[model samples]
Target: MEFRQDINGLRALAVLVVVLFHFGLAPVSGGFAGVDVFFVISGYLMTGIVFSRMEQGRFSLPDFWLARGRRILPALLAVCATLLLLGWFRLSPMDYKMLGKHALYSVTFLSNFIYQGESGYFDAASQDKWLLHTWSLSVEWQFYMLYPLWLLGARAVSRHPRAPVWAVWAAFAASLAASAVWTTRAPTQAYFQLAFRAWELLAGALVFLHAPRLQASPGQRSALALAGLAAIVCSCLHFTHDTPWPGMAALLPVGGAALVIAAARHGLWLTGNPVAQALGRWSYSIYLWHWPVWAALAYYGAHRQPAAIAAGIAASVVLGMLSFRLVEQPAARLLNRSGTRPRVALALSAACAAVLLPAGLVYVLHGVEQRLSPKVLAIAKEDGNRFKDRVACEFHPGAADPLPRCVLGDRKDVRLIVWGDSHASAVVTAVAEAVPHGVAYYGYQSCPTATGVHYRGWDNTCVAFNEAVLADMRALPPQAPVLIVNRFASYVFGKDAGNPEPVPGVVMDDEPQLSTRPELEAAYKRRLIGMLCRVRQTGREVFVLESLPEMTVYVPNHLARALLRGERPDDVKVSMADYRARNAVVGAWLQEARTTCGVRLLDPTPYLCADGWCGGSRRLQPLYFDTNHLSERGNRVLLPLFRQAFGGLGARKLAAQPAATGQGG
Candidate 1:
């Protein structure tokens, strides 16, 4: 097969967009389409190789696999080794364990499956993962493992000259149909799984199979090339993290890439340019190095700043260039020199095991905690246990009744009910410590205290859960106080309040349409007022905790890494101005409720935020686990405020009680 400068240029374009997107550059919000571009390119190139060889009756499975091994393994092994070395000293025990687990998956080409089981690619935590980008590589590798066999088999069995092409088209159609269905039903899995992604590669195969028949007049070629570029550019500009991906939305970039490949014979200057060729030569190495560089910067708290992004890109290019020259080319030449494919395969397999064994050990030994101080290790380990108590007290929508174990404090004299979402669950320990009598916790995942807010993603079970909590609250004693704590910013602003997903439903009361921000805000306020009025009518005193300052970064993880490096952990606190800005609408609604609905508002900001900074830790203990939820020890920081709010209930006498402790939910 002859080399195509235009195809190399497409590689350059794809890699550039992906790097830019990963850098948090604002202009290319849809830069994720770069992966789609790569998928198409891979499909076209690989199919071209297989089809041409098969047609000549010279297709060798071992030779093809060996070639692929040479192309992919060297750079990937180098990157994994480098990350493992870096992580050994810089990562906390838990982070190191996760890194090792991911590295093992990366070497085995199962990272996509592992990551799908763990988190969505666009999730905030994904930024911390050094091997996250390898999921795409894994998907491609899985496709390569089977695609050649399928093509060869089709050629052998079918009498039709274009049987292989027909087979590729059939697979493409079936995979495309699955992508459409699974993308809506299980987007994360669809995004990472081969079954849902094969159509993209098949699209490229179709382009290659039909290339000889795609002759065009110069004018038509120019128009087609321009249209292809436009399609790619538009998708890159318009798509976002929220976009349903690699399904219908993916067709734009896949078709565009296909068009570019089909029209490449006409000599599109931009696709054959020198700069494009250079980037294309280094594209694989660049993709391998960029993610870990970005992840390292984030670990050290440089995050999305211009300086950090610049440094990461510079490091990636330098490292990528070095790897291409010093590692990849040399390794490929050495592997190709071997006369037998079995020898090359054995050598590659041995090298892969050498890399994966230590990674497996790291996971088995739980990140080797002996490397860090117990104090630092403790903080790092605390993240896993943050939700323990909530898990115990969780109330389901259709359960028989509220479990007695859900009640905290003195269950014999239950006086208050803590009701809301996970935010309500988060402060259960502090609320338990502050009140003399028992407090029943009714924490349901993603269910807000506000009434009539419907999440498009949530089923009726969420609504039923909210109703169940309300019913329990009405059953409380007349004089008992009901403390309503939720991450109110989410409902009013329709933003993720450090939760992985958006709150399931939209506010549907005032504006059933829920069409605009103002309308959503108004709807949220009305729902909150109704919730407050209902609780008051039940004769329970209503106390609403003002929204806590939501940190933009996961504080504990950031602090853990910083502390491991002997940097000042306190430097990671959120600014009061930024916290207030994010919560402004929720703050206004809280004030309105206090003034108009006769609800007692408890503000923890004075303690949590001071001197222009909202603290993320106190006395070397992390205050919040992730971006917003208070840690077990961090929740104690608000105990004084809890005391003041419940003072009318004679909490002073209970102050002598030892602070309650329970496993995290």
Candidate 2:
């Protein structure tokens, strides 16, 4: 295949958008479409190579696999090896374990499946993952392994003049349909899985297979090329993290890439630009090295400022250039010069095994925590053990077990029913520790106390669970105090009040009729009012626990990383003003409920924050396991406040309470 400067320019464009998006640069929210562009480019180039070889009656699977190994392995190996060395010193034991697992999967071309099973691409924790970008490479490599065989089989079965084209189109249609359906039903899987993503490459393959018959006039070609560029630029600018991706939304960028490739033979200006060509030459290395650089800067707490980000970008560019020159180019020359495909393949396999051996050992040893001090290892271990004691008491949505055990006092009388989301579960530990009366902990992940509202990406079972909890509430004894708690700001104002945009996987449940923030808030108030009325009708007392001050950073992970760097954990505390701002809307609602429905409102902010700052840790012990959920020790610190909120339950009654037995339904 002849070198297409336009294609190289396209590569430049793709990598630029992806790098900018990763760097937290604004206005490129949909910059992730760059990966789709790369997918199409891979499809086009691979198809051209395979089809041309097949037509010449000289196609060899070993040769094709060897070429792919030479093209991809050298740069990827360099990145993996570098990350392994850095991660040993920089990452916490638990994080290092995860990194080792990811590295092991990545070396074996299985990172896509691993990541898909772990979390969504846009999740906050994904930023800490050093090799998250390799998932796409895994998907592409999986395709390469399958596509050639599929093509050979199709060629053997049919002698029709257009058999190859028809086969490609059929596969494209099937994969596109799967993408559309799976993106909505199982977005994380659709994003990472090769089955749903194959259509993108097949779309490019269609262009390659039909190139001979795709001729257009110079004027037509110019128009098509410009339209394609516009489509790409528009999607990159307008699409956001909230957009349901690789569904119909992906067509704009994928089609744009196909159009650009199809029209490049006719001389498009953008694809032939000098800057584009230069960037294109380094695109692969940039893609490989940029993410690790970003993740490392983030781990070191240097990514908060623009100067640090700029420095990281500059470093990425320099490293990319050097890798392309020093590693990728020479490795390719050395491998190809051998003139023996089997020998090259065997050598590449040996190199891959060499890398995987250490990665596997790391996974087996569970990150080798002995490298860190006992104190640091203890902190890292707390991440997994934080909520283990409370697990039996907390029930998941859709569970069919009997109600959770409510034992607390010696008398074992159920007087309090804690109901809300995961936030409530965290508080239950504190309430259980302080209150003499038994408390029934009825908490489900992401299921808020409000009725008639639904989070966009949450399972429908949350609605069922809320209803079940309401039914359970009706069964509680008269005058039982129902404690309601949640991360209310997240659902109401969304991360910030001034910019109340709906998060990607969280939207109004009402279909075909999206509700505005005010509308949703009003609906929530009404539901809460009705719930309060029902509880009061049963003569039960109601207490609404105000949402805690949310931290700007996850305390445990951030502090651990900071400790590794010998930095003060206190430097990352959240401001009181920031907390107050985020909770303003929910605080007002709680006030309204207190006034209108006669519910008692308990404010924990006074206990958690003071003197204009909300500290994330108390005496060097992390207050939270993550950004919001309080750690066990942190929760124990809040026991006195919880006791006071329960009508100053006397010390005699508190003393009468037995030690927690850790029994549950």
Candidate 3:
């Protein structure tokens, strides 16, 4: 139980890689493995504390729980409170609501579950989540809650002293197998959840139970420690965001950390260096403060600026130093001293409620929309509320009603049948309001509206959806237009820069080349053109919307940042040349259809782009809900264009639309 400076230095190593990885600095591509390293260290230290206390016959479960609560909750509550305060002035209603939910999750030690259902750990949207880093803390806290109970149960049931050690290794083996299999199939669960991560922490417990040899020479221990450090560095340098996580791959860092701890050398430069020890001491708070600062920078579109990243890192370290002195140290001193247990417990519950109650109010009040004026709220609108609900019929499958049953206009029988992916669904409300004809909408997320091609991992979902839509087109009158809409450039060039996840390669049923980019792009254009001609052959006219301009930043977030800074969010524009270049192949294929299949092309460029630039917002509203999907208000610009071709305007007129009202957030 003695203070091991090497362990402190190990803490430095873990936090350094994680911080560097999050900041997109240096070459620590696999820096996320640092969390694995910390798991090992915690297992060793906490197990040591529990067993040592038991030997002295003074161990109390409430006391153990209190010690952990004091260490984790104080500094955590500080970060969440600071973020909520900053969010009051800076975040849009939607993001503020999300932050409220995230804050509640963080303080309650359940963020891992919240994040598990949301998105991948390495997603671009991670920038929007101020408390995304708290998932690991939740994982560690879950382990802390369960580990000692398993130990006390094991000691009571078995006469053998070695029972818990055997149990730890047994659990490690079982968890390792499960982690590998689950990571391969359901990576989000493997990465963000604790079931797959328990083995790494248990490996550290094994290190404690089977202590390192005392007879080993100093030279051997130093060599062992250095080798452990090398293993950790190699994992960070060589692995990347795409690496399968917390599986067999994580053993490198977990094993490496266990070796460093077991080596028990306190004087080696790597483990004993002054800077290393300081970072180690401040590691917990540094981890807490670093992400919120960088998340703010990311919100303002400066995450990649070298100076901004430098400033963010500096700010995080300074904030960490201040938090350590003001919050972490004081809480540690008070709770570690003798006092009435119930008083400490009562105060802890009160602090949690203090943070939790306000967060709950923020979420329940809908991010308190009164924070912004009518003009700003107009741009923010249903986007700030539950937008997905409005579009749910198109994007989500209904058990009772078919997906295509989701119509845009009031009339049940539809003349204009819209077909595409979620991008198509996003424009339904606007399209319904713009056109006089009743619209039959069919949208499947991430599914390109083509007959023969699909994403590499996907089966026949998109192809099948397109077939069903084409059948509906065949049943309609010749005058009824079959509109083809999708985020087409994604099929050709992969996801936009602002999008998360590794690019899913396009695959064709007949292509000789499997998932190669060039071959896939060629096949995509061919299949798209073929589908349009097929629509023409179905005896219906085909209208294709030119791909909308995609922004490099999530539009709502950018606009909110701009407005918070007293700048015009509508002033935002992206390079038109760049948009044209990104979709050059798509445009060419659509143009080819005009001659080969009589398909008409409608360009969103005029509505979204002007003077060699594509804007994310206009005078009244932001153009997009996220990176590429147009907001309902923003998509209203397309109503004029759609009306010109389809020949009917709905009851709602865009110009006559009233401005949205607001509430204080």
Candidate 4:
């Protein structure tokens, strides 16, 4: 198969977009699509080479395997080993364990599946993951593993002459269409689905099978190449996270790449360009090595400026050339010459398994708890068992157990009942301390203690759970000082069901308008009034902890970066006034309830926001566990405010209190 310099330049374009986007460059929100473009190009080139050889009776599985081993494994192994060693020295035990697990998955080419199974990409845990980029490599490798067999079959079907190409092309088209639909309905699957991505490669393969004449004169070829380059550039600028991805939206880059590759550049203007060709030559190695280096730099907070990122790109290219010359080219040549590719591969595979097996065994033997100090482990237990688990129980079929199941306070002379959803869990430690003598808590995830409004698309099982929590609250034994606290955004944004799929920026209609402020506020007010009235009817003192102001900045992530740079994370806190302004409607609504609905508002804005700032902190003090949830220490700091409100309602005093301790994470 003849090499195309234009395709290598296309790879440079793809990697450029992804790198810029990762560095917080605004214009390239959709830069992640570069991976998709590579997939198509890879499919095309690999298929073209394999199928062409098979047609000439020159196909050899051993040779093919040797080629792939030389191309992929060495650079990848270098990166993984370096990252693992670095993690062992500097990362926390939890992070180190996670890195080990990530290594295990990466070595096996299954990281994509593992991550998809664990959580959606939007989750907090995914934010700090260093090997998250490997998921795409896994997807590609999985394809490499399967695509060869399909090519052999295509060769077998060549008795019908054109039938094989047509069949393959048709399958690719069908898969592409199915992937487009699935991308919207189940994007997580769409992101990792091998079948959906096959069409991109197939499009490339079709170009290879036909090798149709360009028919364009030199000038026209140059014009087409320039146009293709323009399309690629525009796509990087215009795409964003909200954009429907790898679906119809992916056509711009994929098609542009196809145009550049197939145009075969008879024009001296493009084909003769030395820099483009050089970039093209090392493009494969550049792609293989760049991300991991950027990942390490980003992890360590080394590269952020445009100049620095550009330097990283230059360094990547330099390293790529060296690697292509020394490691990749030599290893491939040696393996092919010696005919020991499989044996070498088996040995490498064994080494990986040997390293990974012990890591897994250690992980299991210690359990996940070995990562943290005893106090942190205790806090984590409170996070999971007491709140996350039990609160999930409130909305089903019966009342939650009236015992303060997960609260961290002393278990004696129960006085108050904390009621609502997982927002209550954020302050579980505080609640435990505030009520002491164990407050009877009633809460559930996604189930607001409200009636008349039913949420759709939630699990059928949750219908009973919702009814149960409401019933339990109704039966609460006239406990005064019943506190109703919840993260208000859920009610406003219709969070009872689940997060809505991110609507891409290119949508033609008014879906974004559907999630606007008025609709959310109206829903919030309705739920609040219903809950407030019901609690007051029981002659219980109802205190509504209006939702705490959420920090708009992704504080912990920012802090991690700052910490790596030897700066205090607290140097970056934004003002709480900003938060108040954003939630003025909710605040005003709370004020109205205080005046008209006889609901006492326990606004703790003062405790959280000093000098009108309501943001994250890093003063060796925990603030948020993630975006919206409070950390255990953050909750501990607020216990005094909670206690004052509960104490005012004649709440029972603490008895047999457990000593609360704090530990370094």
Best by TM-score: 3
Count: clashes, candidate 2: 1
lDDT string for model 3 (495-600, tens) is: 7544423333577766635555555666777788888888788777788888989888766666666776788545556898888887887788889989898988
Alpha-carbon deviation at 152 in model 3, angstroms: 5.1
lDDT of residue 593 for candidate 2? 75
Model with the higher TM-score, candidate 2 or 4: 2
* lDDT of model 3 at position 234: 95
Clashes found in each candidate (C-alpha, N, C closer than 3 A)? 13, 1, 8, 14
TM-score of 3: 0.87
lDDT score, candidate 2: 0.78
Q: State candidate 2's TM-score.
A: 0.86
Q: What would the TM-scores of all predictions be?
A: 0.83, 0.86, 0.87, 0.78
Candidate 1 lDDT over residue span 378-428, tens digit each = 777666546465665776555554432367766545667788777887788
Specify the highest-lDDT model's number: 1
| CA lDDT for candidate 3 | 0.78
Tell me the tens digit of each residue's lDDT in model 2 across 154-253: 8889987577777788889999999999998888888999999999999889889776677688888788878887888888999998888899999999
Better of 1 and 2 by lDDT: 1
Higher-ranked by lDDT: 3 or 4: 3
